[model samples]
Target: MNRKTLVLPAVVGLLAPVLAACGGSDDGGDAIVVGTTDQFVASKDAPAPLDPAIGYEAGVWNVLRQTVQTLTHIPRGGGAPAPEAAKSCAFTDTENESYRCTLRDGLTFADGTPVTPEDVKYSIQRVLDIKDESGPIGLLANIDTMETKGDKEIVFHLKTPDATFPYKLATPPAGIVQKDKYPAKSAREGFQVDGSGPYTMKPEVEGDQVTKVVFTRNPKYKGDLKVRNEKVELDLFPDAAAMGKALDDKKIDMMTRTMSPEQAQSMLAKPKDGVKLTEMPSLAISYLAFNTDDPAVKDKAVRQAIAQVIDRGAVAKSVYGSTAEPLYSLIPSGITSHTTSFYDRYGEPSATEAAKILDKAGVSTPVKFTLHYTTDHYGPATKAEFETLAKQLNASGLFQVDVKGTPWAEYRPAQMKGDYAVYGMGWFPDFPDADNYTAPFLDENNFLNSPYRSSVAENTLIPQSRREADRSAASPAFDKLQDIVAEDVPVLPVWQGKQYVASLDGLTGVEWSVNSSADLQLWELGRGRDLPEDGVQGEFEEVVLGLDVPVEGHRG
Candidate 1:
């Protein structure tokens, strides 16, 4: 939901006058600077070694999206994945069992090496081979093996039918790389980023960790995207207030990571001097993930008891202040397969029922459990949100709660390794589909380092849902899956929040740059003077070519 929520018509209306004013030079000259808090990228687990197979966060993706070329590109306004690095791609038959794509002619890396079909196969296989726990290796769970046909074609044999596979390829995790440039056995730790996308990173400046990071447009890019700026700089600050102050002083032209609910609401609803707000619908969900490996939270009764006691309504209202809506299921509301399973199971907060359930299970009163959260990444509201959670659980008197927080830099890896007893989890969708919401969290080895494994979810429900090409046909399976999650309670769904980006008045393309799922398209953005009079408002040109014949490849 990182897209502007005020509808395209409303955005167009606002941009009409803004576009005219953009012709003037009052905004900033030449380079465009975007300000963000240091937590934008995890400080310790920074997106460095930014090889697609390793990094998995907005900070890394914000740069990778502009530099890495994928097989296909999902447009700003969401729809079917369009051919990008691929000339054309499709399933071999009606089964949705196998996927194939023909590489675009003359595709070359920034280093001028040919981006052959072999590189595509290598790029994907390497990720699966490395199997980085912190990476997005699980996103490719459906892919059984990959085969390459000559230099231009590649086919993916899926373990099961998955209609959403193409959407996954469009993400950074599937970015193709030359095998020679990157190591075949392990990640090339210090390899230079030589990609075929619209931009390349500028040489790192000293103290860039606390100062800034920069990217320059890649002259070798073959895609149709218009890269207007000579440079794009991400000015990093210690906190949001400093970032905001820089934006107000015109030291930075834009600010993006995320702000506290109070800061976002105040800055966006009532813009400062030359700044404007571009708000979008977000598919991001915030929740509590239990490390079922821990003895304290391993019991389902304890999880269910805690779930029944906490009030999502009070958390949403008091902590988020209308910035977020209470979530009842893993599949967020806007997606097709979403269900109110959690809400239906636990209607309204009931401490009495929780106490009774715990007592019957031989669990004593005031069950001691620790709750972990990140200090940043989700925004300043996270502190308040977790505080509210601890307060509610402690108030129930059936549980004794302890809340602790670490910076996101440390929290993510530790949580993934099941280092926390019970922790907070937030998800920003990789794609707009419900599969993205449910599959990753419920997989055999999921984002949550929980010991609650559901064979029904892994074997039957998820597979059944992935097979159907028609999304609505898959809803029943997804519904059943949600019901199981509600009963199991490995991770308790909490809230769904909106996306907000603020920028100077003259910056064109902010509205058009955000995708349906709220991923920002940095390539689509440009400085005011360079942008077209209509901004990036017009329709995207359709991809016309289609191939009926299918080719096979050598499976490793």
Candidate 2:
């Protein structure tokens, strides 16, 4: 999804001065109101930010998950792909090149129209046909063609063996839309949804931006999910401070997506009477991406020199505080096939090593380039994070970097145009797999939209890893891919984040609300008994404050 930006509990002892008000809703209502800092921008250059074929960010997917129905989905406690719209799905060939699915009985769209297998085929084909550069078409690149039988069965023919195809189908990119409501050849503009998922969406728009989205239970939804609440109100804010204020004012029932590190630290230190904070593990990573085509950083040595000099620990500590951990690889720690290739190759932050690399390549010292970042997307701390990175680079006396900040609306389009020599971006995975980390960044048609490309990694190692049904067995290929990324220095890993959700004490299922991929499963939340001040009694066990809890069958 890119920071699209997607926190840790080890430094729990840290203290912050400011403390916000916290309490539960006194109205005792059945509906839930949640606050988030996620924003979607529609402009002349890039319109239809929420269209399944056009939207690719994590925030965009978060909204699509509740309204759009995919054939397969990751269950509450995530593992393999489970049937959602389809009754069942599996590979039909021994080579894993052919796959098939059968639709469930009486499946209907949100508008009460019957959902046919042709709709599934049409939705997928349109994404490939539109081929928007900023869209999720890259995820479906392996699909050669699709065929449907009558109204029930659908089959997919793949260009290569891909066991991960089911996981890819579980993503919002494969969200099934009614053929009549959505155009076949182009993206449907405006803020609206027409799918057969668990929720029926009603969006509130201010100009081109979606200010709020109201989700009510879809009676026509026939999926694997159990909707706990009748309605959910997702309130979008401009920044973290405003979201926190809404939570304090009791305008929202809970706050998710992002709470600043300082706020989390303060809440951890001082317990509030009716507020509970849950920290969940995430497969999200923030990194620095290089436009290899840009003149400022075209040389591999220049990229390598920046990689050697910048200190990740300092950026994580000073900017993020205890909410994050320094990452040294493209793949995060929890995922399979993770390696410390960058750390192993570069050792530590050293000016001498950076200078030596530049000198060896006959390049000039004090390398000058602009580092661009988004102002409103990741969080308020993003400004500080980029400034800290610039300080680290400048302190080495080997580089002179000018830091620039733009809102996500403009930043993303410019990034796709290869306007920035060095830019900051974050990724929340489409699924919980190492391939999600590798393929999206290193592939020929990468999500970064940068000129960076590795022929061996894209053509050989990535395809080799996907061929294995047992993902753990694919570690060797992924390890080699990580090594290639380290050698190329196209993107430098900065930090791996932990997901945190702050909720009222009267709310249930906070731990299970966000999945391993950092996607919100709001259907799990319900009104329940007032939780104890010290801990929450979850459905499975007692979850205490400051302790990591499992979300979707995996520990955070």
Candidate 2 per-residue C-alpha lDDT over 299-358 given as tens digits, one digit per residue, 9 for 90 to 100: 999999998988888888887777788899999888878889999999999989999999
Instruction: Look at candidate 2 and tell me the lDDT of residue 73.
Output: 77
**Model 1 per-residue lDDT tens digits across residues 1-556:** 1101100001100111111012212224456666555333323344344667776665555556778889877654555677778877888866787888888777788778888888888888888987776677777766898899988899999987788788889877799877776777677553245578877765343432435656677666665466666667666676667866665565766666555567766754676665566555666677788887788888889999988988888898887665677889988876777789988998888999998879888987788988887775555667788889999999888888888989766776687677898887667667667777777778776655457789999888888887777777788998998998889898898887766555555577766665434454665557665644222222233443222211011000
RMSD of every prediction: 6.8, 6.3
Candidate 1's clash total is: 7
Report the lDDT of model 1 for residue 495: 83
Model 2 is weakest, by summed lDDT over 10 consecutive residues, at: 7-16
Residue pairs in steric clash, candidate 1? 1-281, 1-282, 1-283, 2-518, 3-280, 4-279, 4-280
| Clash count for each candidate, listed in order shown | 7, 4
Candidate 2: C-alpha RMSD after superposition: 6.3
TM-score per model over all chains: 0.87, 0.91
